[model samples]
Target chain A: MVRMTSFIAGLSLLAVLLATGTPVQAQQYPPVGGRQFPLNQMSPPGTAAQWAINAGRVAPNYLQPVRVTLPQDGKVTFYESLERPVELAAPAQAALLVGRMYRLKVTGMEDFPGVEFFPSIELIDRLHPPQGREEDFPIDFEFTTEEFEWAANGRLITKVIYLEQPDRVPTELLERTPRITTIEPSRNVLAEADDLGRPMAIVRLGGRTPDPHRPEPSFFGPGGPIRLPAKVTQASAQQRPDAVNSR
Target chain B: MKYYFLALGTVVVVCVGCAMDGNQHLNKGEYHAPPAAMMGRPGPMVDGPGPGVLPMMGGMGGPGMGAPMGPGGMPFGAPPQRPAAPSTTQIRFVGPDGMQIGWLIPNGYAENQLVAPARYNFFQGGTYRLKINNIPGRDSLTLYPTLQVYPGHPNTEAYLTHNSVPLQLTEEDIEQVESNNFVTKVIYLPDARYQELAIANVETLVSTRLDPGVDPIQEADKRGTIMAVLRMGNMDLEMPGQTGKPMAGTEQGGIDQVAYSVDGAQNQFMPPLPIGPAGQGTPGIPGAMMVAGSGMPGAPISGVNMAAWGMPITGTPIGLNGPPHLPLGGPATLQSHTVRNRSKNEIPAGVKDMLIDVKHDPGYRLPPPVSYIQYTEKHPVYSPGELSMPAWAQGQQGQGQYCPPQQQQ
Candidate 1:
């Protein structure tokens, strides 16, 4: 029994010594080639790929969430509402191929059925006769339905992303951009069409009474200067330098 | 002679008038202040007080301490000395539930790696307060768990530092450690340390490297040293193969969706996107655009310089989703615009994926071809406990965790 106690006591002492003697940091190794590894989680399952797929599956025809970069000075009209499509310029535009596809990306609007992009006619590539048909060619926006839905409503799309494809575009005209064909909207929306020349239509429409709160109270009110008296010019210095002429 | 005498009398009269005018200046009085040395000090206290005198309370008959009585004989208590304002150095610590508070001197062989001061340890565990003078009230410090592995499969455990007891790995702590891996203790710091870490760039001096041969504990004792670093990590245990496919709503899954950064450390992403030649200049090879300006890609923000880490090959930051060019899974991968340019050698041998130089044209002048270096990690390349210090400390520095020399001495 005494021997057993002694043995246990020795073991306990050893454990304590090991714990207290070697500092917590002493055990820290250089971490090179150790089991110690940074455990980064994989891309979440319902993230980009899944969300894109879900959005694509529900809509009849939708713009893939491919992020499209407009060429330098490139501008595209994003149809925020079916009533009117507002045009927004690209981050920057410089190299614009006359007939290449410039992709645009949008997000969070699975409810938005489709959009109309109206690029300037000059931005569109028109192949001369002999090279191709004279008819304006519509730009092809590729939608990936592979295991990963690469393109979703909000994905960034790029111009010249599809230059290598031989089927939709001719190899000789890879540098050229596709012409934009205007798609008319459903007739019920627009009674008198504006100069855009396309038939007026509305895909989605709804309105709500605004909240009781005033539109975010802005500090930027139109104002003449408050005419605050900055300094009490000791009544002695009230006269201006021109006062000498008056005297 | 009579004219000169009359002139002198007239001058005297004029001088007298001038003196009287000076004396009649507005608000003038005969009030005279005593000399500077005798100015504000009160007269010595009288032991026996009479009328208008304060009665002696004990022997505290000092000039500043004595209070004179009013006509009503009301004696004012030494203008109730305002309680000394709480010291900014006083730090408060609120411990986890059911935590037993103990004092931690933070003294050990690993002292260099720790940021807490080594002079004293406090036992009150619920919350210990330290006065952080410069730190804002909102300054928060996140404590990440350090992991330890045992012999058994799936035997990895995580433990967080507390003032309770010097954390010792034993059978008793196993369960607590396992449960604590998910518990990322976010403690608010007195603003002093918070501002220090917040404004410090990635390469700010957090820890220093200890010499290989020297003993850390001995060195610490020789110099009373203290060091603080922003310890950061995800709250989920994501051991590669063990963490299957991160499904949404799962702890790991949620973390995966969001980009990771050192909890409080500011991350800066500046990728010097190659400037393209304007409108149909000679179509050069897509990837070989001339590097414009002496701009290096993805430099660290704040004052911490990262010049030591060779300038990384630059890629444009696409939105806020982090540097898109890196092929997933690196220290800088998910951080906004931060990526470590890996040398050709670091590309693991037999890296399965093809290196594709895909040009990212986000509707702007075309960006240089973004080379995506793809590889897969069935397991993490570095330990979860190990943090990737700033790029400046990248190479074979002080064993991953850099501990600066003990400055306490």
Candidate 2:
């Protein structure tokens, strides 16, 4: 019994030494301010290609849950709406393409269904026509089957990303770009129209009742400044030489 | 000057208040900060009011701390003593969620990577915080140094330092930092030796290199003077693959000419040059006309840039989708006016897709061919000779939307 206790104690001591001896990899670099990696979760499952992309092998990890890049942080929003479900079924079960560096979340769901997506690093290829913009390389995901039902009522499709995002370009092989993103509202509730003429997803619609508690709720109102009060302040003040003039 | 000092003094107090109390969460993704009371607990009366007044606790603007107020609302305190705002020095960690966050960065952590979102399920209700700050000190101190991080896969928890120079970390080391370059951490250890990786911003650098003799612009100018580059805003030339120098004495003056720079860090799709320099006066190639700049191909609003492209090569099948005569996954209809230069005389220069060298593609071992996108009166932007778009439905195409129909010879 005493020998057993001694062995156990020795093993415990060794374990503690190992734990304390080596500092965490995060220790090598400084802690990030305000930003946190959603590194805590096991990534969702998919094909070998998807796993390769998420595993930081073929590409950087793009399919972690709950990481947000904000508009204030050089982010842009590519939006589209579907009256129904959104389906990102690519050819040969390939990955769908999106346009933006986004931190996708289900902020507030209004009768929405499940969101299935594959954060394929393959889509992040720069050789494609629209290369540099991280925004233009949105990873494709699958949507719930009932997405078609929601298409009739104008579902919200929004992807907040970098302003310098790319557009719907060719498959990195040749030239030309489509102005509008295709949408099958039936497949994707927030999917935009496939006509290619409609670029931005439905951020707002005419005469839609908005949330009363929103700060500066004017999305497409007159002068269309999201923050009207800030606009008024700027308008009232004399423009300084260094004052920014953004729409 | 007087007002400035007063403002400075006021700022000092506020900055001190923020620095010392440790109440507000540090912007760097560190452990959640402790509560004010927890951070500054008042002890028993064994020492009779304790050391006359703790320096951090007695300062005005301190977090919920009680300081003796004086006449005119002055705290009558010594100049507020505050720890320096986190130096622009940084350490970065990419979390399991792929969110990049750090405590020290040129821009604070908020500007660098995404934060982990709140989770409602499987809440552990607990997380631990570790603070280790033994950095491998460099020869000189410079802020905002680029860190080439090497986050061990799966384990994801190892901090190390190796490059003697802060700017010499390998591309693989810096790969972890590509997405989240802003977040960093501040750690103070008993030992003074620091060993965390240092990364310098690619944009913050302007390393001198011999300009390659064969300028793409100069070559293209044979056809047309360099106009503008069609810089793609989406892609970037990250030189993470270029590491380790060739053997010494391999080039003139010991400079390795064989080295390749994953150049053009920004401006992805936009062309890199006009025809040649505008003075070269080389006419654009046939079928490649300088296009007018519009905006994102699909958006109604138009934006303009100086990237010059001949008429776009449109109406080709991008991928396989439907049968011949029908475009499957191709752009429904596009206008190519987004090209910066629109003058009919200006044949904007562009790289012909078939010939341009893949700068970073490791597999293809062939020298890049010099081909330009030319503007010809015939077959303007669209209308390819054969329906050769890769994945879409193949079919005879009418003239591209941006391309005007040509008159019959």
Candidate 3:
């Protein structure tokens, strides 16, 4: 009788296990059109969507979904994959003018799975002179698309579009400041950066950029202030951070 | 008792089914979301065209629809799609008898990863050669077909050569091209994490005073011009051992150089570029820059000169006879090492004041003061394979230098 009872109890346990199925949660979102990205593990679909929105590639004003082809130099990479750097297309490069905004359609992404493509817009106004490192700009917002379609070749095509915005460039970006020049007596300056971030003036004293491997010139060392050109007074200049701010 | 046995059997059967389901999930390995959660089109029109408004993709050049065509049309929103970006395709150069000669990744593909089937990103509609495998000694000489990916080529497949022609390169030509005439692609990451690591590595390599060897992965030639430096996947970090298996072969530690195989087909139609020393021209023997140690005047190694001889030039050595071999004075290396180091260090009080002084001072044209100096050594007079000197003439190669007796003190 005990054995019968044990068997009955085991049967009940088996029924419960089968009813619950596996412990793994079922996938919440089924892939569009029943096809998932081949290398989906590397880049989540939602992340790609966000990149599209931020880049202004997917926007509301998009009349129709226009596919923006990645140019020869443009790079498409996955999240956290820092080793990859891609170039921009000439047309894409041109569209990045300051005060001008654009909306692009995300397409052809289905072909390259596990890769996320982000367009890097120059932070400085396109019309302004290029700044080496200080041209501070932020990336566009991330977005998602409403449509999904497959090309004739069975590649999934993204149908997201970014909206365009009015040009809101700062006046300072368009207005150029006159270069400055200052001359003083005690310590002379060779070059300087004006308050407006332009090169104020450069006094070429015939000194080459300082080399650190060799011993410091007798006048300048770890002991004191750097040697300045003689017969010069209080000078104000900005040097490209050759030592600390550059690679 | 009979009921107990039956129950246990039933439980075992259910457990087995559950295990199978678990295995299925693992095998699929893809994260999926339901269709309802996706970003569907917005309800109200926010800007430009209204929501669900589809413009004519056809012939009409409507005002807001088609926009302009030539150059500046469609400044924003729904610009015409250009050709797709070309992608890197994994290819194995198969010999006539089907032997695996070498693996080829496009110029920008991640090279450090172990050989696997992957589609790398490249420029669309660009033409390039599939040569220049990065093996230490065995540079495949057999010519492969030049690949020109079509503008709309699908990125889903690997690049395969349907037709290939072999060229008869004189051993000297091979030597020249291998040393100097090849193209270089740099791997760069804009992320701060990578930047920190790169800065740290550069600092450690520079400040340690213990002459660290060139980075095995990303190498910057003495010109400060960087070629490919692949550091991405674990597969790239750990190369398969000599037996052609990871960690299983006799040769286990140290660097595992890539292998190359040259078999059939060389494209004779396309002329090789002139990459040898300038003035010497194409196919000409490169002018060798020989440095004799103070003690060992005659014995010098051919290609090993780059790492061994230490001159104060600011770039890494690019081997003998390689292109970009800066003749005694090529301009300073492109990177500013001092600036990189400065960015890593905290500003001292006096230095901060000096910066303010410069910013305020008008005539400071020479830029900021550099903290240190970097120098690249000269190349050897002869190419490695082209070296005709006697064995004793070969100087010691690699990181350790062949210092002159006088300089040794």
Candidate 4:
């Protein structure tokens, strides 16, 4: 009863039937190219946390993981859930803060110098509640010549910017400077290499400093530089009509 | 609880160690570290050797404070843990000129409450002074200058003092105080941070003197000022939109019309010294020159014939008032218009300062600048009758029922 669209946008609105999971929606926007940030997803433990409702088909919990093919090659595991709601700072503008959370997963792919996707990240849509613009939000991860390569797999090449959303657009996010924080093998790696032979899969970013956290989409209009208005926070995702069958 | 007391004991030891090593030097940085107001000490009397409890003298001949006085009335020694100059707490005020006037100190509020006498009116405004007093939560604040102009007559002899300067003429005297009566206010900060000694560090000792190693936290030190700006005026008097929240519900007190520059500038007036000998007194006449002269007003002659002090004085006392309400000379409704169409036009320096008489609108008038407003807050209160319902409710008056009118009836 539902449809799932890939990373490519349809020239005209087309609907396809899905096996079960994915919701049937209109045309989906392509993912924005993104880079890895060094920020941890959790709070300081004892503090109260704001949570996000599960609306997407994939669940990025300890039990299950989603796999997606990268533009370069090799497989990346997406923990389609994990990240909860948080109030992050919208860069540049000293006033506004973020209302949504990144739907993240520490993937099992040599994330660097490769196209690793940051999926399910929902930007508080001005009109729609909980529904996300499709493919998943993408992050362009690059590697310098000095960085070591995975002897088995070829090096990765990233599309740093989304060709569609330039600096002039309202929802177009800003470019993040290429600076790597930390990268290492995932705890549960399918294959492990010691002689610096295999590419390390999965890297976590964002520690004490800034730099890596996703930069806000810059709005240049009217009075010099204007930032996007606060995302009208919606309570919960709409319940799927065929809830029992969605699983 | 036992650990807490032990920690207190350790604090005692470190305090002793610190006393031996703490520097007493006051002028090391910006603030006046040494406490003034002379205090007393249990010392040997000036003329006593016989066993008479040893008569003592004061620190100005009264209570000795944390730092002792050195040669030529300066505080001696340096504090052991004076923070770097930049990290020190700074006391700032907005002068009549609207510029930030600041004096950085290596300390915080003396105790949470800052009380001091003004040698003069406060030149600076805004957050007046940061204090480091001993009070908690509500202390560590400044006593703001009560901006009042002298209301009484100048002819009274009781007005002058032994020093001859008006008593209110403390260091930061405001020129406006020459015109009003008394101005007063009290503002307290609900959150003020301070150093608290741990209960355990009561007895530990390092080198027999007060030591940080003994009580670590308790033995630790911090500094603050005893002075504060207690009075709070219109918070947004300087910045726009600052008064919105406070101005919404409760009506504010009236403030006289003293229009500052609309484009964000302030007016300032320096003082003519108090009427005394060094000021206007004459030589041969004993006190005549100093007392009779106008703070030597016209002494420094200028090229301008305008009273030598750059003030407007006419043949028949111009620019001053006759009695109350009757504005002197004209209604100030006069305006001048100069037609210019060019962009980035030159004002031609002094030509702009020159007054060019213009025709008035006659019936047209403008109102004074600043106005008063009301404010409200969410004051939580409880009601007894409503036991079954959720007690915490919101209301404008802070009390009453939340149920529908029909249901209550």
Candidate 5:
């Protein structure tokens, strides 16, 4: 009888301990500030390749005016198709589709004799200029002398061109020369540019050129469509600065 | 039966007491339950005050005293700690144009010659006195400043690796310094939410520009991660008989005696050290070693007597011995060995068809590929008089200009 009573007391003690034990809940820390969403989850404003693939998802046929400025005298040739090429003088303006990537063959650069550069321009976003006056404030794709030298020396240079926010513009009068800031390669250029101002375009310059005889088709990319500006009349052309210089 | 009843009653009373105590603890608001997002998620947990325990009583097994009991008698662990900052940080001196920036070395002041738009890596978490001189168009004017570079934080990992902190003295800053007033500049990269502009740019908070009662450092902290702080005053650090001149063989005013030159010929500039969570190794820094194959082999199992007895080596073939001339070890004697299976089995009497059945639990479905595309293009229609062909297109054989058919009015 004494042994049975002691055994019953031990059984009740075990039951009490089991009932008092609580479930082990895991602990969690708050998400890092400004990183509520993972980077890959963000849409549209991403890498050049991502922008190219998803450019027309919102507006299929939006064209942004882009002006190509060379360091020196050079001709920019745009390919319409496999064999169709349209050549234009430097400081040329064209209507490029937003989100599409285009390639340009730059030749006759007085600085780099006998050398040609095939640079790519990716237009991820567009400008909203006044109606029919888009040419006045086209996105300037100027290739600086330093950038040209860097590209010629086999270094890959990626430049992100952005429009300055009106309110955040510096109070002092800045020079017409665009403010160019080079960041580390590991950092996301798109993200950095997006923080300062609206990124308009991305220009990638490398030393890769196509072969003369057996030129690769993919080197020219998909040859996205482009609309050239209307030809200038002979009377107006004569009044132009370049026309006068030619004379 | 009576003993069993007595034990059951004891357990019932204890459980009832625990329940009442838990209810009272919840009513007193001593315990704050974790957020819904944090609940059940595994991470670093912060211990809270135990039930019926006060924070002041932490010494007596209370909160922050190692696994404090939570509301339901659950023990919560301590919170996670922040990682240590890197030893060195690179600071870029952007320009006010023609201004010279120099920092104090060990023994003396490394004076002017480090012009604006130069970059140098400095030891982090140290306050260094600086001399600013040679201001363009402002001769005979100089300002002494102190720069404090804080350690890196988790929030600044990406920003510090990819971007350099830009320090520039604007015209207003110079004017303020000339007025014999103290100026405090806080250089920081604002958080994404606090960033007003689309492009990320380094922002500076000037003490003179802000409201009188506002603290620039505090405001900058609320806005973004602060990289460095510069406090400038009109005080002349290089006064005659002062501790600015180079002291030979002796430490002057707690500064080291080493001299650093701006040209970096005497003492090379400290390269920027990679920091933050990236774990990127610097160009010249060594990192963890990587072995190529399966690593080195273990010691041989054969005994020493095997060499003296002329026994075949472990790697030798089972029946082959080493070269007859050499006793210890040489090339194996076995040359060629082959294995073949000659046994065959009879074919079954009748075996012809084979069938397989596969069923997907969730069937794969896809939209049919696009078959037809309709494109409509709009272009300006020119009249016959207005239509003109370019010189290059006019001479081509099939490129002659033809006017489009006129549309009905």
Candidate 6:
């Protein structure tokens, strides 16, 4: 009787083993796509959604606040439209649209006399500061003297600005000046920045200037709308700028 | 007891069946041979003439002698070590001021010119013999060196395009060369992790500076990507002949020829001919060509055969020189050639009958795509008297708009 009971127990154990293995075998058949990007291990750029926005599939952020800080006193001009050119002093504050590329002209640099630089800013993503305090936490676009010298020497300077992820970085007081890390040309700067934090914008400075005689309309791009802070607008009004700022 | 044993055996068999079912989808096909070119070993044509044919040849030693014959009784060695495509790499010659740099052409050496901190564009994946003369201190001494520009690799492409390879002959290198010692210098771009400084710069590895038996080429390769290699020796390549002239292009003298020129008008650069019996043409030999296959009918065998009367065999030759000693056997004579494919079939039979039923589990869930976002906040109402608006803000809304209405959505 005992032997017969053991046989029954063995058959029951086999049944349990067979039942447990079926689900695992079934799950192995199909493979799921990974959530993270394989090359950079970062989320895809927001610019990728431009096509969807154009097709009326998604909404875009308009007038994202961006602050341009030059090394020395300089004039920053933004072509709001072919007919409208808004000029402001250095440390200029403007709200640009996300997923859009804008061309800005810098002149009257105290250090670099008589030299003009046409730099481009591509906002891939936006910041989410507390409501009504967007002006305080504007995306910083700092230009150094070294970068200007490199641009003047015909070398293209590409800088990627990213917001620091508090958890990933060491806990310390943030430096007053923006941290600049120059890497090899062959390295993917976007990927490197993404590894450290969330990438927000890409700034490219080159020695190319616009031809006055036969100006290329594409050089100015599709003049996007820009918004100046109340203080900046008041200061510009005091100076009596060339282009009138409209609401 | 027998009943209990029977039940246990049945359970064991069922458990084995369940385990096998887990691995049933795995592919268990026969391994197939890869392509001949992918094997990485040299092919038959690369072995050149067998060992005894050219005993005195420098690089043609070892494997050329007694290496096992491949199919069709042909000797095979390692695969051709040539780069994929021809690319021009700018090489900057730095240091040793007043040094004259010249390179060997097809027939003789090109004119030497003073080069210090000068740059020249040279085609990569080639080994050129250079004539170094008029050294600053050692004015009477001359050196014949070989510069081998390695094929550009993906790792070094960016560095080569933006920066030139700096080739500086140091004082130690000159001293070693003057003492009748051979020196090899390898220029390489060190990898990021191997670099000690923040800036990326090219590093050089000299054979004389390294420990004995340590190859500079291998060391450089381990550190980074090699751009070019310069090997120098004290051999005099332009010795005088019995006729009181330079031995180049003379019978029973030097074998150098002017195969290429810096100025294209003199002689267009051609890829060096392959070494061995399978090569199309021999270098330094006036009009000598090597044919590997039997000649086709009606085609001349090295310009020796002619079409017969009423039976013309008209077709392109199989090899460059056609058949060796050819004559018309007959117009209708049968010629046979066989081509065998050595590749194997990796796929197993009855694979079409296998069923693949892959589907996502119903329990798995993914977050829905973002469709809408709304921001609602209260703004302070400003009285016209309290807040002064600028002219631009009054004319517009104080906001510059460039995008279309649809994009604003």
Candidate 1 per-residue lDDT over residues A101-177, each given as its tens digit = 12222322223234222211111122223222122222233222220121211111111122223354556765665
DockQ-based ranking, best first? Answer: 5, 6, 3, 2, 4, 1
Q: What's the distance in Å from true for residue A165, model 4?
A: 12
DockQ of each: 0.00, 0.01, 0.04, 0.01, 0.06, 0.05
Question: How do the residues B1-409 of candidate 3 rate in per-residue lDDT, one tens digit apiece?
Answer: 5666667777776767655654443434343322211222112111122233222111111122223323322234442221111122112122222221222332112222211111222232344334323233443433232333222211111011111111122234334444543321222111112223211111111111223554422232222211122111112212345344334335545453434322323311221221121111114433333333343333355445444556544443433332343457676443432222224667566643332111211111232489989889998775345544332233453224344333332
Cα lDDT of model 5 by residue, B1-409, tens digit: 7886787686676678556544434442222232222221222222233233211211112121123444432223421111112344556677777787766655445665367766555555667777778888887887778878776544453344323566888889888888887899998866545555443455889999999989998899877778788889888876544554644434335444455444333444322222222223324644433322222222223453135455645433435543444335776555644434465868677867865454322122233489999999999898665655442343443254442333111
Show model 5 residue runs off by greater than 4 Å: A1-36, A39-247, B1-88, B243-409
lDDT of 1 by residue, B335-398 (tens): 5545454545555578678664543111112224879978887975654445445423434555
Please rank every candidate by TM-score, starting with the best.
Answer: 6, 5, 3, 1, 2, 4
Could you list the chain B TM-scores for each candidate? 0.14, 0.14, 0.17, 0.16, 0.43, 0.47
Scored on chain A only, each candidate's TM-score is: 0.18, 0.20, 0.22, 0.19, 0.71, 0.74
Which candidate has the highest DockQ of all?
Answer: 5
Error of 5 at A82 (Å): 40
Docking class of 6: incorrect
lDDT of 6 at B247: 37
How many residue pairs collide in each prediction? 66, 137, 96, 124, 12, 24
DockQ of model 5 vs. true complex: 0.06
Q: Give the best candidate by TM-score.
A: 6
lDDT of 5 by residue, A1-247 (tens): 7577768678767766766664432211112322121121111112343333333332424567788998898888765334545567897777765655567788888888887777767676778875556756678888988777766554456678888887888857355677788765434556567667877777776554553323345445544456556553233344542321110
lDDT measured at residue B266 in model 5 versus the true structure, 0 to 100: 43
TM-score of each: 0.15, 0.15, 0.22, 0.14, 0.33, 0.41
lDDT of each: 0.24, 0.24, 0.26, 0.22, 0.56, 0.59
Ranking by lDDT: 6, 5, 3, 1, 2, 4
Model 2 segments more than 4 A misplaced: A1-102, A106-108, A112-123, A126-142, A145-247, B1-409
Which is better, 3 or 5, measured by TM-score?
Answer: 5
TM-score of 4: 0.14
